[model samples]
Target: MTADARPSLAALSAPLVARLIDDAPALRLGIERVGGARVVDAGIRHPGGLEAGRRIAELCMGGLGRATLGAVPGTAAWPFGVTVHSAQPVLACLASQYAGWSLSHGDFFALGSGPGRALARQEALFDELGYTNAADNAAFVLEVDKPPPAELVAHIASTCAIAPDNLTLVLTPTQSLAGTVQVVARVLEVALHKVHALGFPLDRVVDGIGMAPLPPPGGGFLTAMGRTNDAILYGGTVQLHVTGPDVEAEELANRLPSSASRDHGRPFAEVFAAVKGDFYAIDSMLFSPARVTVTALDSGHSFHAGTLAPELVERSFTHVP
Candidate 1:
């Protein structure tokens, strides 16, 4: 859930984190079906891609009360499949829970064929990874740079055509299909660690951060987040409260009247001016858990924690994220 609300940094161990990157196919890791035929024609030359799709389906089914992984007696799926609820944490734990798929990294690419348009889109997807076409799969995995929705849909479409009446899409409130949530958390944890080591104040660190949870085209909860910590990356004047950019303060101020317009260094400056002192107390309702009171913490900001993942619109990365 929220690495932020975590009481101590001790929860993160180097070895535990390292275990997430294994090149194995995680079968029966609790997938819920969003709704689809038993035989989906996911078009992918890469086994990894296909497996990813299958995992999504399993998770979706689990959410719909249609199926599950374990062999529990009297389970809805019966002898073939059990039943699971669509939950983000369940999806996130898929890989870790499965250790016997025995699928190899290279074998992953051989599962399905890529259509012409899909191959073309792969170019852009690969580009998003900041890699040239020459980059191997092994090299590409070094970073988690997923393609945007348009490209991703085209890629999936080219790989496997969903059958008629199979258009259902289920999701876990805890996560998304885009695999964004899990990856983003890892990134944040790293940044969090670095900032903590440097003795950066928690509020200051969280202030500049922005988050966006991307929906999964597949059935699993693959939430993603996009952030703008550029201010910290470069030697900017304002130590951004978080990685998120605050140049939109005026706009945000206008949009959220109840909250102070604390974009980047601007709001802090205002607080400093009002207080006429070195330390200023700055609080804001700039972020909201839209479902409940404001935007979700997963949409951006760690106020809600991971367990409380709240859905956010695309614009969340700007203000609410």
Candidate 2:
């Protein structure tokens, strides 16, 4: 399809919404009417269970990718992993999966992602891609422990140019099973964001696939957050197929991994605590997959950077002594 003819992510993902709603009872994802908006509590205020978390992870990709549970090699404590693959990686990952926007109101905050971002068009990254969608309905994923207020829902509807009833909000907390699965599912997204940050043209990226281990659940918010971040920073691996100049693709591959950051040696939780829990204080470059491989489709040349830190992965996943 031509760039201008591309469908809105929200429109493209509507089927997944219907599927989730239809399987709501089985998935343990509770759906309810809140302020005329349809709210799916995947984790917050609901167990969301494991199946729901897996489905939500897929939904976060705007239904453009598949997210399934698998095993990460050499990891016994948190052996399960979230695997993601997508033909529309740019649209599904960077434009949809990456939580690039912070949605906040008085005493309320959530990192917003999913197809709703395309409708909001508030991020500067959207402008750079020349991508926007005019969908009559919208879907958003919020990582928070509490349901949003009615006013917040109304504000989202207005921003998306849709009626409150036409909006869908999926909520998941970082401490929950669903939240952890969805966050680790960002392996491909994290890689794309790093490449974009390094000034690579995203349109050249034709496909992406990635995998990162899912840590066992039990810890509270901070610990869960740490393990999820560690999963990507220490265990994740991403491969992108691009139809671009060989030199540029090689350069991107060289600079794309998390090890490229000076803060690569320690567990992410330690790094977080070192910054006194101020997320912004940590180096932005530290947020990426452990290994990245970029292949130039035109020249059949490939380049790789970084290596998986299984020791740190063990420390973070198991909290071992």
- TM-scores of the models, in the given order? 0.21, 0.96
Q: Where does model 2 exceed 4 Å of error?
A: 74-77
lDDT of 2 by residue, 1-321 (tens): 576876668877888888988998887778888789999988766687767777887788888889989787645666779899999998898788878778888999988899888888889988887788888888888988888888889988999899999999999888789888888888898888887888788888899999999887636888888889999999999999998699888888888899889888899889999999898888888889998899999999999998988899988877832
Q: Quote the positional error of residue 293 for candidate 1 in Å.
A: 19
Give the alpha-carbon lDDT of every model. 0.23, 0.86
- Listed per model in order, the count of residue pairs whose N, CA or C atoms clash below 3 Å is 58, 0
- The worst-scoring run of ten residues by lDDT in candidate 2 lies at 70-79
Error of model 2, residue 315, in angstroms: 0.7
TM-score between model 2 and native: 0.96
Model 1's TM-score against the true structure: 0.21
